[model samples]
Each structure stands twice: as structure tokens, then as C-alpha cells.
Target chain A: MPSITVKNLSISFPLYHENTRSLRKMTHLFISGRLRQDQHKKILVQSLRDINFTLRQGDKVGLIGQNGAGKTTLLRTMTGIYEPVVGHIRVEGSISTLLDPNAGMNFGLTGRENIYLKCSINGYSKKQTQEIAESVADFSELGAYLDLPVRTYSSGMQLRLGFGLATAIAPQILMMDEWFLTGDAGFIQKATKRIENMVQNSQILVISTHSAETIAKWCNRVLWLDQGFLKMDGTPEEVLPIYLNKPYEEIVKKD
Target chain B: MSDHDPTIVKEPVIDLRSVSLSQNVKLALTDLFQGLIQWRLGWKLALLDIKLRYRGSILGPFWITIIMGAKISTIGILYAYLLHLDLQHYFTYVAISVVLWTYVNGMVNDSCLIFTSSSQLILSQRLPYSIYVWRNVFCNILILLHNLLVIIVVFTIFRIVPYTLYFLLPAAILWLVNSLALGIIFGILGTRFKDIPPIVAGVMQSLFFITPIIWKVSSLHFNSNYVLLNPLYPLFEIVRSPILGENVSASIWIAAIGYSLFLWIAALFIFSKTRFRIPYWM
Candidate 1:
């Protein structure tokens, strides 16, 4: 059996607004006991529709899409952050998601303490988390400042700490959403190498990124999504050209 | 040699419907399990929340102690004169009530914002939504500790005789259960309704006067039914009776425990069903 499965997933958002005229119309219908159902039919925005796929061990799948094409939504749904309005997602093993690198840290906490808190939040055992804390401190290179409150740290320092803690633990399935770039050039190089090592041993890795270069370099296969629909699925070389060369003007005009 | 007797391998059939149903169950289980694990880490996060709020200030959390002391002393003196009560006795009552009320107030105000304040964490991580509630409760306890300092100082200044230490046993249990029950209900409701916190604030302000925070329950001339009708009355009695060295009624204990358990179960049911909907709503 595949490690993870997603079938016919759809998410819809309702638009709600109150207008004086509509309220009056609703009140009139209410008094008559024959309310117009059509008046309140929700304006649905389908965020993800009929998403079907299977993920297996050693599969590095890159999810490519525009901002509103449901890239983030899909990743969140996979991590169980958001439930699908329709369909389902299954995972056979524990999954670690780095949807946002700074997700659970308290800025008031020192870097060392935040490491333990975050690692535990990510489901690491107390002893295992403490073991990783030493390594994270070393990797982040913030030195004695690791004992100071994270709120006092610069953005680069925060990124380094967040990135270090995230990449320290090995998970059965890894999900990433555009948090790969750590900003500092040196830290980026270090982080890339660390991630590469982590991914090699990871059973399943699903990454969502707008950068075609990242998909080409990191993913073995690419799943192209456009407007919440899977447009293409194949090797990076096979899908990237078709996705990049599509007529942007015509696509926007269609909407 | 094997070509003559080849073995056939068949691929598994994909049942789309069953697969989807199983996925839903798996996701639900994962969310429940995550909530349990995250509960353990919530206290640390809550401490961080408290510390962050007062960081960089010279007085630090001590400011909580100082402000509470000044407010209670002013009211204690004024009320003692107006009600013709002994200054020492009135001061002790004011000190204890104010400290306890601060904890209750903190829980009510913070419960509504638990989900809203932790939006960044909830949206990004596959964490249990209950962690926010636990964090809010834990942080309130830390603030309550700060307020305890003021209570201790007042006790010393008034030279009140030390009552039996056994008073702490029931007080601790009652406060814990009360905070947890109220936190869960308010946390769930506040997340669902945006207007709940402000309304809760208004209600609590009214409750402070009616619940004897500034006056003795014995001093009120109203019927006993009025006190019985107030939901917060048992909770106040649980905390105040022991501190005042008075006996707590068994009926009050039964009511407090019964009401808290009922609220807890209801909150759990609602939370289990609606926690998944929170990210979308937010």
C-alpha cells in the first residue's frame, strides 16, 4: 500500500455579507413563512476540488501552483491543519510538517528553551528533544545569546534558530511549504545541505514552492496544479515546460 | 527452468469510497492524539506568554503585586469606614477576594482570545487546538502567583492569626477545577463568537459587585435565593470560606463540582466536533 493517499478533496468557503435591503427581504419572507432559499445560497469559493493522488516511500513530489491555486491549502490539508469540505487524506506513519518554521516558538523564551518546547510540540520525547537541543544550539551558532529571549534576536537569528530546530528531527513523512529559504546566504547553503540529507532518508516528502528551479533540483516528480485542479503529473522535465509555457493572459481571461 | 511454471502477481484494487472514509478516520485520530501530546507542553508555552508580556520592564511581574496591593488597600480602607467593619478584618477580606477575582477575571478575558492570539501556531503546525486553552489557563495561574504576593503582604500587615493549613487543600482543588471548567467552555464559545469576550467583561464587572468581592455575603439584605441563583456564588464560596476560616457548605461543594463537570463534558463535545472548523473560521 502507498504511504499516503488523497482522494476527491474539495474545500469551499462561503461569502457572508449583510445588507439593509437583503435584511428587509429576509424579514418579510420570515413573517410570511415562505422564505426564499435562493436568497441565502452561499457564494462558494472552491479552494481545492477533486484532488486525488497517492504517495509512496521515497517519493519526492513537488507541488507547483500560483498563489491562489491551492498550494498552501493542499499542504495544510495533508498535515491535517485544514479539513477537506469533500474527500479525504490518509497517512500510514507519523508526519512532520514545517508549514511555517516559526510556528510554535515563543519569542519570550530563550532559544534553548524554545527548542525543547518546539521539539516536544512536534512530538519528540523529552530525552530525545534534550539531545537535539545541543545540536540545534550548535547549528544555529547564536552562542551565548541562545540563553537570551528570542524576542531580542534579529530576524536572521530567528530564522537560523527556526530552521535549525525544524531540520534537526527526522520524520517519516516531511511536508514543506516555502520555508526553505532561510534568507542569509551562508545559512541557506547549510540549510539546503541539511534538508538534502534529511530528504534522502525520509519515506515521503511533499514540497510546495513557486520556484521552478527548486522543484527541478529537489523533486523527483512534479504535480502541476492550476486553479485547484491537477493540471499535469510527471517528471519535472515533462511538467515544468508545459506549466511555464502556458498562455498566462488566456488563463487569467478565462477566470 | 522457472518459465514453465510462472507465478502471477496481481495489483491491489483501489476502492475510492472506502479509501476516503478510512482517511477521514485516520485524520480525526491523528488530531486527537496530537491534542493529548501538546497538552504536556502547554504549561511552558504559557509561562513564556506571561514572561513576554512583562519583559523589559524594571518591576517585571512584581508590578502585578504592587498594583493589586494599592487597589485593594484603598478599597479596604474606604469600605471599612463606610460599613463600620474592623479595619484589619475588612482588609483581609478585600485582599483575599481581590486576589481570587483577578484569577477569575484573567481566565474569562483570556479564554476568548486563546485561539485568536495563537493563530500563527495553529495555522502552521499540526497541533491540538486545546493547547491554546491550556496555555491561557497556565498563564493565568502564573499571574495569580503574582497576586498571591500581595495577599501575603496584607496578611502580615494586618497580623491576622494563621488559620489551619488544611484550608489550602480544598481551596486549591476548587480553584483548579473551576478554572479548567470555565476555561474550556469560554475557550470554545469565545472562539465561535467574536463578541463573547466584551460581553463576558461586562458581565464579570457586574458579578464583582453582586458576588461580594467588595462586601461580605452576610451583609446583603437580599433573600438567600438571590445568592443561590448566581452561578459564580459557589465558586466564590469555595475560595473565600476557607480563607475567612469559615466552614464551606456541603451543598456548595456539590453544586460547584456538579456544574463544573457538566460544563466540562459539554465543552469537550463541542470542542471535538468544531476544532477542525476553527482554521477555516479564523
Candidate 2:
């Protein structure tokens, strides 16, 4: 019953002069509220423009592009993270997105505590979260380290914990930036197997990764974007060969 | 990564549906209410926030209570002597005043951080935006409850038992409501401007001294009534005066209720108009 339909969806980020990277200028702008918006030039980054796609149940979508080609922005929009400024997205399913590992953690909390925190954020009950916590801890294999603060864990250890907790839920729509497999070769193999199984069972899977090999293996469809424009949409066999033929730099020319 | 790749693939395959304006307003109200209505999500995050904040310290949040007790005792003796008031009555007044002031101050200052600090969770997860605001307000309330123990100990020392205890509930309830509404607005405005949190902190610092927080309203020879014109003065008096067993002012109750209604409307309006813009701003 899960379906994703996006039509003429254009999302442009508005960057005001006062809200720029400089702290000193922002302080001046803060003190001077009388200044009008038109007093300074406005800049808007057109992250996604006129993107149209319909993804039915069981569609494994592999999103491809160079850095800042709106791949991450597109995935984020589907989960309702970034709203489309011009168009609209209609998604009929419960979406579970693993966009970035860094944003969803409190390092002061233990691994087990983080697991419960994430579960509750997903709107799970306490008893349900407790059960999910057990599986997450087991899959992460942090063992007694789950009791210690997650700050003590290495970056690799943190990634494993994030992967374990995010993939535990059986979602109608699953979105991820990359295939989060880390640690030893044995652990990588185990993670790959788990991801494959989830992709098989889930109603839809949308992954944005650079590797053509992973797309060929996991995806039936490919969405290629450049400078916020949807350039190509086709089977991996048709698109991947053409997409990979060019170097990344030439393809990533800014608009 | 496809510069040479043709922009045209196929003619549009998906239906383009126009989103109505009403849907946005509905979504905004949902964002605000969802954070409050979903008590489970709010409380869990709040408890975790408070726990993590005091994790390593020995006395934890009780440390606030100890520091507050010392401040009250020292300030009570000095201010009462300086102002020519009875020692016991003035100490009790300062104790209740400062405790309630801490709660208000904590709510205002911490509210600015609700959305900015939780930008990570907001960017990755599909949560009702106001959940972070609720967590902030709830966390401060938890600290307020802890500080109430100091009040009980003070009451025991003064041997002033409360016969009109029920009168304090409405004032306390109004205070909590104000904090929740004001906190959400602060969270939204604070997120967009990026510099608002520090500016707000500076403003609050000045407000503490300007407002009749350390001294009584009657202590002012001139502008004593004008001092009550400060919104904070009425808010502070509503809760603090009730605890001190003073006569409740009808005008104070009216001003507090009227101001609270205005804040709720303004907060909801700004929140609904700007909720979608949060991701872009972040």
C-alpha cells in the first residue's frame, strides 16, 4: 500500500545576508531590526527543481549524483525534512530515514539508552522499545559497552550502533544516505546481509550512494540529478553505463 | 553527476496535486499540539535531557537547590536590614521570590535552545517540531519541582503553615502555561535568527535587576506602581505573592491572563507561518 508520488517538485533554499556564516554581521543585523529585507541582495540555492517521479511499492531506488547535486536534499524531502517551495510530495506510508549518523545521537547517553531514546522518537511504546532495545544491543554487539557512555566509543563503534538501531524497525519506506557497513570484514559481511534482507522485505527502499556496483546489485531504477535538475531516470543498465562514462568533475559543473 | 546527461528523460509521469493553504495551517497546529499531546515522547526526552545534564556531578540538580538556599539566606539578611523590614518576613519573601524567579529565568533562557540544539534530530527524523520545545519546558518544570523542597524547608523554619494553600495552584498553573507558549516562540525565533539566544541572554540579565526580583515592589519610592507595569512584575507577583500568604490582586490576575492569551495566539501564528522554513534556516 506504500506509494511515493512527487510532481514538479522544486525546492530552493533562501539565504539571507544577515544569516550568513559571519557571526559579527549577524550580531549587527540582530541589533538593527529596522533594516528591510530588500536592503540587501538575496541568494537562493535551487537544490531541487522540477523533479517528477512516482515510486510504487517494492521500488528499490538508487539515487546518484556528484557532491551537492541534491541527492541528499531529495532524500531528505521525501521524509518531510525539507519542504518543497514550489511543488508538493504525496507519500502514503510510514517513512524511516537514516539520513546521517551524527544528528541523531546524544554522546552523553549510553548505547542502550540511545537505543531507547531513538525508539521512543519513532513513537514506539516503552515495552515495545525495551524489546527492540534488546535486539538492537544484540545486533550492535556492544555487549557491556552498552552500559558505558557512547562518548567512549570509537567513530566506527558509533556507526555500528547507529546502523543497528536504524535498521531494526520494519518500515514501509526506508531511506538511507549510504550502506552503513563498518568494522571488521566479518562485521561488514553481516551488515550487508542484514541490509539485503531488509531491502527484500520492505515495501520501498531509497538509497543515495556513489558506487555504481552497489546500484547495479541493489536497485532496479536509477535517478540521476545535476544542479537540482533531474537529468535521467531509467533502468540501471541504461543509466549507469552513460552516467559512469564521464568523470565526476565534468558532470559536477555548477549551475 | 551528469553535466553532459540530457535534462529531458521522459514526459512527466506523476500527477501534480496542488497543496491547499488550509493544509499548512492544519499541519502547523498539528506540529504544536503533537509535541504536547504526545506526552510519552515529550516526557522521555525531557527526563533524558535532565539526566544527561547532571550525569557526572555528585549532587546533580540538587546542587541548584543548595546554591539557591545560600543565596536566599545571604540576600535575605542583607536586603531586609538595608530596607528596614522584619527579618523573618523578608527572608521568607526573598526565598519564595528567588525560587519562582529561577524557574521563570530557566524557562526563558533554555527555550531559546530548544530547536537550535536539536537541529540534528530535526534534520534526520520526522518529528513534530514542537516536541523539542515541550521537552525544554518540561525539563525546567522538573527542576522547579526539585527547588520546591527548599520552600518546604523554609516554611518549616518560619512555622507559617498554609491555610490558603489551594489559592497558589492557579497562579502556578498560569506560570507554567506562559512558559510553554513563550518557550515555543523563543525556540522558533531563536532558530531563525541564530544570534537571538545570546541577545536574549543579555536581555534577561538586565531584566533581572530592572525587574523587582531581589527587592519588593513597595521598596521603590517613585515609579513603584510603574514598576508593576513590567509584565514580569505581574507574573512574578502572581506566584510569589500567593506563596507568601498575601492578598491576591484582581488586576494582577487579569493582566496575567490577558498577557497569556496574547502570547498563545502570537506564538501559534508565527509558528504556523514559519514551521516549514525551519529546515531551510537550519
Interface RMSD of each: 8.3, 7.6
> What tens digits encode model 1's per-residue C-alpha lDDT throughout A133-208?
8879888999999999898899988998888888887666788987777487888898888888878767788999
Task: Give the per-residue lDDT of model 2 (tens digit) for B1-282.
Answer: 112322343211222234455766777787767776777788888898889988999999898788888888899989889888999888888888788778878888888878878888888977788778778888988988888888889889988776466767887788877887888789888887778889988998888888877778777788666865678887887777666777867888788788889888888777767778887877
- What lDDT does the true structure give each of the candidates? 0.75, 0.79
Q: What lDDT is reached at residue A147 by model 2? A: 91
lDDT of 2: 0.79
* Candidate 1 lDDT by residue in tens digits, B22-58: 4544544554465556666788788777777887899
Worst 10 contiguous positions by lDDT, candidate 1 chain A: A30-39
Model 2 TM-score, all chains together: 0.89
In candidate 2, which residue pairs clash?
A: A65-B1, A66-B1
Per-residue alpha-carbon lDDT of model 2 for A69-98, expressed as tens digits? 889889888888777768878787667787
DockQ score, prediction 1: 0.29
Q: C-alpha displacement of A143 in model 2, angstroms?
A: 1.4
